[model samples]
Target: MNTAPHSLRPLGCLKAGLRQARQQRALLCRQMATTTSSTISSSSQTAPDHGFYKITDPKTQRLRSAFAVYSPSAIATSPSALAPLIQPSTSSNPSGALARLIVSPASPDPLPALHQVQIKRMDPTGARTALFAKTRHAARVGDVLMVTHRRGGEPFAGVCISIRRAGIDTAILLRNHMGKVGVEMWYKIYNKNVAGIEIVKRRAKRARRARLTYMRQAKHDMGSVSDIVFAWKKTRKVMTTRGGGGGGQRLVVVLRRRRRRGSRSREMREGVGERRGRGEGGVDGNRLCSCYLFC
Candidate 1:
């Protein structure tokens, strides 16, 4: 037997001790991190993982989830009340209905000052005699329209900032910005002074205000990409299991009272002779007794 002093232990023992110490230290650190993380997660409110704060209303003390402030019920019906908001207001009876027309040059070749093309009216009503014919689809505010001048020159293209559809003197307020300067021109559809008018782009389905003067003042047309990302985070759905099998169904089983194990074994032991009489085991009483003992 080779005996070594505790101080002069084998290299393997020293390695094992160091390994155990390291494992203990690692476990202690993991426990501390887990406790800290749990504390953070248990807080009442934390910033979302997507990195955006929830907007709260100061008055209502509720989250502001919508982009617009006005609700359906709060919409003002009076034109005077909505004038300050720069929203468009039309009369109860509109004048000659608005329509779109293809205002191209009369000639094929493009000129330096003026481009010549034939004009084609795209009104739903088949009326070529009148310039302002009643049509099912009328041009409204926020619609992009192209207006050709009387000299068959380049068309004046802009978005309809406003529309005044009051009787025979109906007119449209077209706004076109040149560099930093903004230019607005009002045109009567029935006037022979204007060559033609064509509807280029329709307004968005989600447009709130009829007069989109607010758009000119806005820095951006739509919300930021971060807003969209944060929106999805705000509207997460609850998780659920999906299947067409018995796995989703929960069943409750009721079990009847069972005989006591000891009582059952004793009964089997006493009935061993009766079982032998019935010729169950062929002349093996000891085997039958052992089986009854384990019953």
Candidate 2:
């Protein structure tokens, strides 16, 4: 076979090899330029330094020491997430006030927190004393109560006839019999003069109605008041005493002794009689003396 000249070999193969070499060089240059731009951008984005060296860096090894110096709760901006949003309602004692007796911060222990209820009518001349409950839950329907009146020396022992439980204006109806006569007394539960209320017995019956009105017409059952007992707490009185020499203040309580009825009037009568004796000797003087003493 005859050999062809090397220069005269296919001119198309030589042109294709030159074109491929140019394309590889262009791709290499583009990749090098892209990698250089990314490195420069990353180095320029460093964070600014704060003056406090202890908390500034994790590499300093003292960031935890600064955090331990402060209390988390002292700087907190919100209340505890677990606490309830509303307070539960409680029954009020006779002083037209509601108070809770708390024993400690960690544990809230309940105790008897009310005392001494007296009632006054719209007329200034009328006043009465009745038995009072120390707390709302301390008194209930179908209970026997011993009420001591301010005027009468003897106590009125009765069964709770009815109860009107309007918040702040709660009252109880009490019933007792004098021979053949039935007597009923409606007492405001929160009065200040109610000397004391002692729950002698609690009836076994659980009354559905808050008021025990059915007891009024029904015949008496002697067995209803037996075999049940409950303990009661007396209401507390706040008595203030003045400090002597004034270094520190002290609290003192004074117990009130029961007073007899009409003793106050008798004292006023004796004073008026003496005043009349010194002023004149006439019918007008005698009448004035008697009016002040007796009426």
All candidates' TM-scores?
Answer: 0.29, 0.30
Residue-wise lDDT of candidate 2 within 1-295, one digit each (tens)?
Answer: 2445665566767767765665554344333332143442332122211222344346743233332222212222234311211121233331211122231123222221112112233212222222233333354677776665556586565677677764336677777665656677877645544454556555555567776666667465332332222122111111112123431233211111112334575664454445335434533432111100001
lDDT of 1 by residue, 204-286 (tens): 55246656777566473222223332332232210011111442231111001112445565564444334334433522532
Candidate with maximal TM-score: 2
Over 4 Å off, model 1: 1-136, 218-295
After aligning candidate 2 to the native by TM-score, how far in Å is the CA of 44 from where it should be? 64
Give the deviation of candidate 1 from the true structure as CA RMSD: 44.4
For lDDT, the strongest prediction is: 1
Model 1 gets an lDDT of 0.42
Deviation (Å) of 142 in candidate 2: 0.5
Pairs in clash, predicted candidate 1:
105-116, 105-117, 105-118, 106-116, 106-117, 107-116
What is the model-wide C-alpha lDDT for candidate 2?
0.41
